[model samples]
Each structure stands twice: as structure tokens, then as C-alpha cells.
Target: MENKTTILSLFLIFLFTLPFSAQESYFPPEGEWETKEATAYQLDFAEAIEFAQDNEYSESRDLRQAILKGFQSEPYHKILGPTKKRGGPAGIIIKNGYIVAEWGDTERVDMTFSVTKSFLSTTALLALQQNLITDVNDKAGNYLWDDTFEGPHNSKITWKHLLEQNSDWSGELWGSYDWADRPPSDKNIDEWRERELHEPGTYFKYNDVRVNVLAYSLLNVFRKPLPKVLKEEIMDPIGASTKWRWYGYKDSWTTIDGLKMQSVSGGGHSGGGMFINTRDMARFGLLFMNNGKWEGNQLISEELIKEAVQPSKANTNYGYMWWLNADGPRQWENIDENIFYAAGFGGNFIIVDQKNNLVIVTRWLQPSKIEEFMQILYKNI
Candidate 1:
């Protein structure tokens, strides 16, 4: 009788702990993802699902038209790389690395504009981790040693400044001028061109030209295509699909070590960036939610991941190309400030809610409705 009682107690303990241990140990294998019913986790996400489905992005499914109409105010704006018709609203909500809910065609690949910046910033962090970049504060010119960073003000720009989008890197790359991108609406072309340049790290501006500079610099450091580095180092290890592709402008090619490689763009502002599926995007969010660890391997250093999300001096709502929920213009009210996300122009988002162990990936959602959607999702969580 005593032996039987001890056996019963052990069985009860095992039954209670089994689910949690399974949740912690499970990592999706290549070409496969695991799913769990929301009720199993005691989560009611019906309201959040309905909200997301109802609030689809109002832009045309034809993204080229949307891009042109959106950036018509900017002079010489043209689609320089590639653009494809986007699919309808899609998303996935992962809890404890298991898909608790998903909607639309999550496998459809689509262009993710500025969200590519976050990936671009990751490559730089990897370079730093590998000692290719001695320090973030070191002058960016020190690495490239070329005409791109030769001018008086341009020489002062650092990797951190570029990552923060405050580099004010004044130049042209792939035929796109620094002054022409999202220039001040209040100023004419000549006025915008001749405006006084702010010192790097002192001002924040979301200029794709400078972003491309960062991509180009990373190409020089890695001595290979950024896409190759990303695939081998991060994506494959996380079990992301092969459907994803990164692109650069048509003419954005350079010869390195006698081999020509394309330096990919940081966003699809002029039509080139990361083209990826929603499921893969969720996997990426899961990786970050786990603090840069995938399975048992630390793919990216936790220190770098923490630093990537830190508020920069120039913008409290901005990190190293990652958007923050800090008290700033872009803050999502009623949301936890610790949350950070990768955002793109066409309403694509990979929100990392580490506090709740949630990774939400939404594509083609109405840009303005994200805050409300997040609030509803948080309530459900």
C-alpha cells in the first residue's frame, strides 16, 4: 500500500508537468510546424482574429500602383527593383512556439518593405559578434575606406548612427540621391537638395539612400551577399522556408574579391527588399522571442539582441531598425512598452511580445488599426 501511494503521487506530478516541458522543448523541424488549439492554452483569441480579418489594409492588392501613388510626392521616384501583387490579409499567432491561430494564406510570399531593415541590422550585429566590426561607434568609413564616406560630414557617420537611421549619410547609391528620398514636403527640390546637413547621430530621418549605404557597407564587410549570410547563419537554423528572397536595385552590383555581388536594399521603398511568407516571418519572431536562441543553439548573441531593441538617442520609439513601444509618436497606447516589432510600408509586422511569450505576424493589415488590434489581442492573451 505504501509503494502504491508513492507511485500514484509520482504519476500525478508527471502528468501536471508534461505539457509545460513539451512546450519548452518543442522547436519546429524543417518543413514542418506544430499547431495547438487555443483552448488548450486557455486563450480566447476569436475576437482578435475577427478584428484582424475585418481591418484589412485599404491599399490596392496591386502594390506597384500603391507604391507609385504613395511616393508620388518624392521627385524621381520609380520602381527600380521588383514589385508583385500582394495577397489579402494574413497572420499567425504563436504561443510557446506552437501555432495557436492563423488566418488567410500564410504561405504566400510578399514584399516586406522597411521590415528588411531589421534583418539588415541583424547582419551588422553578426559582424560585430564575429569581430569584423570592432565597435559600433567606430567610423563607418574605417571599414569601407572608399568615396562613399569621404566627405567631411559623411566621414563622421558610425555603424550605430546608420543602424539608428540618423546617419544623414549624404550621397547617392544605385542612382538614388540621399536628398531625393522622402524629402521635406515643405521644401522644394532645390531647397531640399541644398539644406544644411545635420551631424550623424544627432537627428533621425528615415531615408532609404542611407539605409542602402548600410547594406553596401555590410556587403563590403561580409565580402559576400547579405542573403547568403542570413540564410546560412539565421534562417535555415530557425527552420524558415526557402521561399524567402532578398533583392537589390537593378544596378546595385559591385565586384568584391573579383566576384560581383548585389548589395540588397534595406527596404522596398523603390521596390526591393525581403520577399517572405507569413509562416517564415512567425518563425523569425519566435527566434527573437526566445532571445535569439533557436532550439538549443544561440544563433545570435543575446547581448546583441538586447542592444538591438534599446532606444536610440535620436528616437525613443526606434531601436536598431526595430520599432519600439516606448512613449513616442509611434507608441501603441495600452500596450506593454517592452514590446518591439519590425514594420513595413504595406502593413506587415512581426511583433515580439516577450512578456507574454507571444509572436504575432500580420501582413496587409491596415497600418492605423495595428494599435487597436494589438490591444484586443493583449486582452485575449
Candidate 2:
């Protein structure tokens, strides 16, 4: 009996000393990253591939030609710069920091449209973190003394309001009017243009002109081109590729503090936003999923992230520039509420699901089918 008891104790020690079956973290180093089978993460490989193939966009119209036609007819289309030829359906599913599944030309750099807003938002957050300006609620007029932040209606706007897209900032930015963007189809042009301006923070309107104004203000605050700020601070640290580019219109350049600076756009409404590949997008999503940390370095504060994803009172579905899956009419179905994404026009999305340690980047997918695709993706996990 004594011998048996000693043997059992030795067996338990050995078992406990062995490594557990844990998911491997394969954060790509510089330019090299490895792919793993989906089954390694307990995902059904066949189902994932099937889901990807079945959910492909099946539009009757040629997508790029249609997009070009639509954008060319916009009121301020000329100011939007040129629309780039977009790539076909492409995406990468990253699980536990490894590429578990990918399809299409994942390396092809393509226009990311409005997803640039999230990066713009991050730049603003970086400003806050660096104490360039104190408090997000502080009035914008304090830092930006130009007419852009002037007047009765615009004077009341705050950094927080701009971040949330509820500033109701009444002005012309980069030759684009605030009311001209996605004007209410139900109302006459005059009625929509002459409508009373809602007080900042009390109403939400997704106007690219206003978003451009935010980008312009950030350019002033940073005292440098927005892209340089993004690259030196966020992108470089996260090991993002150099392929991504942010663009502003030809007229958007201006003299600031004795230096010529180009104010970038917050989205691709007129044209030119982030043109990045799926891998770069995945790196960005992974950075957010790790709570703004990468490779044991805290890139952006967790506090900023908390505020970035917090639901706006005006639009519960939006926070800062990141879309929140809040309890609202536009909420996604059957997914973790904590999952947030940077969505762009033309079905470009960088979805961050921290709950499941997943980052999904899909480009040129059917926008309406996104929720269903996610539902299917999660089911495999």
C-alpha cells in the first residue's frame, strides 16, 4: 500500500509538469509569418473554406465600374481625388495571432474606404495620450484657431464630439459641404440644406465633410502630416506594411504654422483613404484585440480603448470612429457585444473579436451578408 501511494504521487507530479494544449501565438516578425491549419485551433477547416466560397459576392453588376459611376456623380466628386481600381474578393482569418484561413489575393493592396476613420480616430487618441491637448471634452477652438473651428455652431464642438461624429460642425471643408454628403433622400435639397443644426453631441450625422474637418483639426494638433504621425507612432510599432497609403485632395493642402501641410480625409467618400492589404489590416485588428499592445509593448493605452469603444449617447452604434455592436437598431446579430469593427464602404471590414481572440479581414464582400458570414465563422470556432 505504501509503494502504491508513492507511485501515484510521482505520476501526478509528472502529469502536472507537462505542457497543456494551448493555442500558439504567431505574431509575425517584421516580414515573416507562418500559417497554421484551422484544425490546430479546433476550427472545422472544410466548413470555413465552404463558408468563404459560398458567401462570395454575386452581384449582377461589375462592382468597380458601378462604384466609379456612382462616385463620379456625387456633388463633390472632383474633390474626392481619383478612385483606384479595387481588387477582387480577398480576406484573411487570424486565430490566436496565426493565419488560420485565407482566400483571394490577400497581398494585393486595395482601397479600404471609410475604414481609415478608425486610424484617424487612433491618431486623435494618440494626441490625447501624449497630452498635446488635455481632455477629449475640451473645446476644439482652443487648439485650432482657424475659421474651421470658428463661428457659433462650430465653436461649441469638442474633440469628443468630433471623435463621435456628432459635432454637427457646420462648415465647408475641402470644397465639400456638410449637408451634401448622403443627403436625406426623403427631403428636398433645399430643405435638407436649410435644416436647423443640432447642437454638438445631441445628434449624430455621418458626413465625410465633417470627418474631413476632424482630420484637418488633427493635422493642426499634431503639427505634421497625419500619415507621418500614424506611421511613426502606430503603424511602425505594430509592424504594419509600407503599402498602406492615406490621401487628401489636391486642394486640401494648406500653410500651417509656417509649414505646408496636407490635411488627410477621414474616409473615401470623395476618394483616397487607406489602400492596404488583408495582412496589414489583420495586424491593425490584432493590435486592437491585444488592447493596443503589440509584442509586450503598450502602443495605445487601454484607457483610450475603453473610451474609443464606449457607446455614444446620440448614436449607440458608434464610438469615437470605431463602430460598436451596442444595443441598437443597427446591432449585429448573434455575436459577442464586445466585438467592434472598422467598416468601410464596398464591404471592407476589420473585425476584432477579443472574446474569441480572432481578427477577420474581408474585402469586397457583400455588405449585407457580413453578419451572416461572421455567424458562420464563429460557429466553426
Give me the displacement of residue 317 in model 1, in angstroms.
Answer: 0.5
Model 2: residue 291 alpha-carbon error in angstroms? 0.4
Task: Compose the digit string of candidate 2's lDDT tens values, residues 199-310.
Answer: 9999998878888888888888888999999999988888888888888887889887799988888877677677788888999998988788888788899999888999
Could you tell me which 10 consecutive residues in candidate 1 have the lowest summed lDDT? 18-27
Q: What tens-digit string does per-residue lDDT give for candidate 1 at 291-324?
A: 8988889989999999999999899999999999
Q: Determine which window of 10 residues in candidate 2 has minimal summed lDDT.
A: 18-27
Q: CA RMSD for every model? A: 3.2, 4.0
For model 2, the local distance difference test gives 0.82
Number of the predicted model whose TM-score against the real structure is largest? 1
TM-score of 2: 0.90
Roughly what TM-score does model 1 have, to 2 decimal places?
A: 0.94
